[model samples]
Target: MARKTLRIAMNGVTGRMGYRQHLVRSLLAIREEGGLDLGGGDVLWPEPVLVGRREHALKEIADRHGLTEVSTDLDAVLADDSIDIYFDAQVTAAREQALKSAIAAGKDIYTEKPTATGLGAAVELAQAARAAGIKHGVVQDKIFLPGLLKLKRLIDGGFFGQILSVRGEFGYWVFEGDWQEAQRPSWNYREQDGGGITVDMFPHWEYVLHELFGRVRTVQAHVTTHIPRRWDEKGKAYEATADDAAYGIFELDGGVVAQINSSWATRVNRDELVEFHVDGTEGSAVAGLRNCRIQHRATTPKPVWNPDLPATESFRDQWQEVPDNADFANGFRAQWELFLRHVALDEPYHWDLAAGARGVQLAELGLKAAAEGRRLDVPELAL
Candidate 1:
């Protein structure tokens, strides 16, 4: 059977996530023309017509990838009847507007996280997409992660029986303010431009919790902007108005408690271990980016209560690296394939606009809690 051709118009195809989508498109083009397949069926291949600002950059990207269908005008691309989907990786503040326009144009949509800058906007966006009868999805990439996948399998298989709680450790030490140029994007430190760790990373943990444990019922958070100022790439200094780190404690629907510590001030110890250590009645699992290891009661080391003993030598053999059997794409690429399957084949895909709204909900609640110093209930936000 000839593969169905999907004409996609991408917004923010020149940004970081945009470049990622472009690379994926280039790979898809290779597969469409029949080249690389680290092997599964034809899930990854799609015809991506790139779109972005700046004719020179767009032309360079398209020419480099051998793609001719490139555009600078987003509305023009949306107006074209040939475009099957509207893809977005633009800044978060522009997401609702972009998706709103695309849905109005009657196109299926895929975009990066937080979907909307606020919960109200996110809810409206979801409603708009549903009313338009167009398929929609956001990039919930962590679920597709190999380590997280293994942890999910264990949780599903009851290896972690009677799951109790979860603790997530995620952060990296950004560059010093005075010594060097800016380490992160300028918008990241400014709250006005859809910046902050609370908005950026909580949505991620929200999906992770929803996927692994259950829906979050409430959130109690303490957010901080440790680095009051930062320098950009050109040594231009700017006041850091957004929180660089956030500590959130969540109450899941099933009484499962989870804590997430997100920061930009911690040093990277192990290739930046974005990990979750889940403790349950029967076992405990630690899932990092590269590996997922578990320790059951049967495998846990016996401790003689020596306070002087070094931490590294205490339980050396309790953890075992998970075996990798599935041929998986990076979290983003995996969601990209899933969204394509959802749109092209009408296959069941879970990460819809409602899920995206839930992410926004968590983020908003976390921020509210941080600002007001109170626990915020979030049952109304659950999907």
Candidate 2:
């Protein structure tokens, strides 16, 4: 029983998503679990090389995680024949060029979503990967969420007969850094730096809707910059050029209507930062990040409309909570494991670069719909 070590060049390891989700939670967790078991006495070991511009931050991360490999030179790392994968979680504007370099070096690629800021750039990346004949994947972590997994289980078990519609509420108030320091990066509010609510979140909605219900056929979006100005990390004020809020209506393939509201300006009222409510003929379910509650049609309570009186019924108590029947791993880590197996074992992976391009297409179309003030049809992206 021999263990196969796969070297991964993890660029942008100093960034928020890169450092937290990919490095600490996913790769490090995988390492802590003694790598991935490939069955039949075979295992895959992931050797991560921290790659970023800040040598001090990279070294700190490497030392914290007990990883010996750390590098600031991406070209040198990519040039190495032993590096099997190149993972990028850098800012949106920097992703395309890095991916192109990785592809040129003939490395298997995995990256954070949006793939690129624009559809054309995303398509080019996908086509280049295809031309290079290399394995590529994007992070579609929502589908791996415990709540979404339970919802998927319900759909698979036919709990929802004729799903009618889906409503998604996602967002939380982000401080403006005037009195309270802004929680998000300043670049997130600047369009010149590839920042917009539509670009950031529509890609996530696209996959969630497509995977759970059906493909999104059309999109009508109203995107706006709720806050015209914001303070930066250095306590400097700047004009917010990007849209901070996006209200979208998506028409699905199976005659299902989906609506999602994404805004950093809105306050949270739900159990989690994101929540989805799906209504169907047989049953209706509301799922958050890790919890799902369902109300069957037979057990649904009927209420009379009375605007003059205070509500007396505890409506929330009627829905039954879905229990966690199985242990759930971190969503990001789960996807990483799948991608690793796909690379090592040549396993079938549906979330390839082409799929990532589709996500980018959705975001592009969503922005177009917002600008034109009309519904735009989503066309399939040819790989």
lDDT of each: 0.82, 0.94
- Which runs in model 1 stand beyond 4 Å of their true positions? 25-45, 176-178, 270-272, 308-314
- Per-residue lDDT tens digits for candidate 1, residues 1-383, read 24456777877777766785535543354555563332345433456777777888878877876778888888899999999989888778887888999999999998888898998889898999889999999888788888899998898898987888999999888875578655667788899999999999999999999988998998999999998978866678888999999999999977999998999988876533598989988899889875888889787776676688766563636687778878766677667766777887788987889999999899998999999999989877533
Per-prediction TM-score: 0.92, 0.99
Q: Give the per-residue lDDT of model 2 (tens digit) for 16-45.
A: 899899989998888888888998999899
Name the candidate that leads on TM-score.
2
Backbone Cα, N, C clashes tallied per candidate? 2, 0
Best by lDDT: 2
Name the runs in model 2 displaced over 4 angstroms: none
Kindly report which residue pairs in candidate 2 clash with one another: none
Candidate 2 local Cα displacement, residue 1, angstroms: 2.1
